[model samples]
Target: MADVIKSLNLLETLKESIENNKLSDVKDAVEDLLISRINLAVVGDRGDEKATFINCLLGLGPGDDGSAPSPSPAAPEEVACYLNPKHPDFRLWDLPPVPSTSPFQPEGYMEKVKFPRYNAVFVTFTQTPHPHSVEVFLEARSLQQQTVYFILFTSAKDTEKNLEEKRKASLVALTSHGVSLPKVYLVRPSTLEKLDFPGLLEEMARDLPEIRAHALLLALPTLTPTLITQKKESFKALVWAAASLSGGVSAIPVPFVASMVDSSVGVRILTKAQSSLCLDNESVERLARQRGADPARLKELRTCVLSVEVTKGEVKKRLAAAEKEIATVSSKLVEMAMPRHARSVSRSFAAMLQALNGAIDEMAADAEKIMAAALGKGK
Candidate 1:
């Protein structure tokens, strides 16, 4: 409920800024809400499992460029950061596991990693929950960091019964050590479509701050139907904000000249939406590689007009084509919310909004098709 209210409040604030013609505040909101920075730390040392998990989360293959390096036999001595190639604003930090000590001192370990800098901390383990890792979780709790997670990576051969037993055991250990409430996410890196990986993402979306959660949603690949739906909704908010900015600019009273909308604004909004929805060539290629398929086969599934390269000329063409139909709907909306004198501004805002929304809808449909095809489903 708080998340929904917060999102509405943010949109309301942006609407007010646009109404007041606070261009700077509107721009700042765009940066802060859509393209903000989010740091996520994955702590623990399962070597190949750890690296593979990171790759899956970032939509990378084991050998893809920018994927986390497979650790050697010796544990890594320092923390390493891997930026999401698609979304540079989202960073994943792989922290070295706590050193083997007779009596584990989590304070030294936390200090070494600069823990508080991360928006979410994920402590991973393979078979059983590690005491030292739980200690880190406890320490993070003390610091009032509520976005901590306990992830258990299971092997392919692990049966459902075995997984259930492990979950029970993990909860028992966490509770025994004074954890108020315990939760363990059982994941198989090879098959993210199965298991609790999706649930983990949902939890993160709920647990992280609003802006950070929005970043996470856009940064992730549209692997499941749930994620695709969430991404579409997020893009709607973005389109509304960008369109409002255009409307706000044109609505300002002028001396003698008329205000016109810029075609570049629509171009920028559509371009950002295309990449954020993972419909671009690079994102599609990455998703294909993760599925061990050829990129061209998946690219063929993107039949939407906006799925192609978004260019300014194409945007202008769309704006011109959509204006007549959009003006009718937009005029009615503007009539209800705005005055008679605001009709001119309504046309500009309505055209931009309709064009962007149309593109987003087409791109979202293409994304769904590509995801289904990539997952080996029939069209």
Candidate 2:
């Protein structure tokens, strides 16, 4: 009971340190003594030390379950060791009181079994699980409090059915017994350091800082600072490119912008060299050769531009009208520069590139800006 109290006190101290952002003392306290003594307990039919059977594996423990099913064994359950490596850095202790043997009928074999302060318990079973064993594990989980209960079934048979039944029964027992307990983790034992077993270990690491120490040791690489930096660089490039193409869609006739957007920076730098070529006859022919746009889709693509193609007008008149529309959209593009959200981010580069080819209306806004002084004086 005092151990739990001490653990709570340490936790409160840790919480205070975090809130105050003062952790220098924490680092200095236990820098050298960094070993975690993980405690483990084995129980039920499969956990019997005599019978060396089962698949999933964990931390430092021996190969067999101890009294592994002998070639010619006698009512083997009583003669079994509850835990194989009863004493080790990570102790797998015996669970006392094997049901059939009473301490009064000589000595309850289980009564002598020491219930070690364990980190977790490995509840073993076979292929077609006996419901009795599942019941014992469920009861053990309720009593263990913070300790994690992991189920290990080695028989290469349909074991899922028994596990589901245990789960439903455990849920009911918790309500009836009023025992707030941790969930039983179902594990397929393999190698000790197997990546898949971390979740089980983490569950049992509550009061034991040592268990958590090893976990954090493996976890650091996955949460490196370099990964965070890489993601930021990617997002930055995307935002920058979106800014440029959106600019082109709103600009004057300039194919150079397309090349500008094509430049590759660390991420993807958008192009600034704008190219706008119309597919209406002469300009259309020029663009078709340059951009490889399908001849059929040229007109459809042209409709996205600001000016309509004129077939009958004089060359100068058509150019004059096209230039006027170009300047108007150019001004709008500048206005879009200060927009609340990025404009071109959602659009494809080709779409923005198409917008650049609007025919030049010869009505010169540049000339008007220049001749405004003369007109002002006359008015």
| Candidate No. with top lDDT | 1
lDDT of each: 0.75, 0.33
| Estimated TM-score for each candidate | 0.88, 0.33
- Residue-by-residue lDDT tens digits, candidate 1, 252-288: 5532112225777677667777776788898888777
After superposition, which runs of candidate 1 have C-alpha atoms over 4 Å from their true positions? 1-13, 16-23, 33-36, 72-75, 249-261, 330-344, 377-379
- For 5-109, candidate 2 gives per-residue lDDT tens digits of 333344344334323434333322222112223445566553332133221121112333342332424343432233212212333343432354322321233
**Model 1 TM-score, 2 decimals:** 0.88
Model 2 scores a C-alpha lDDT of 0.33
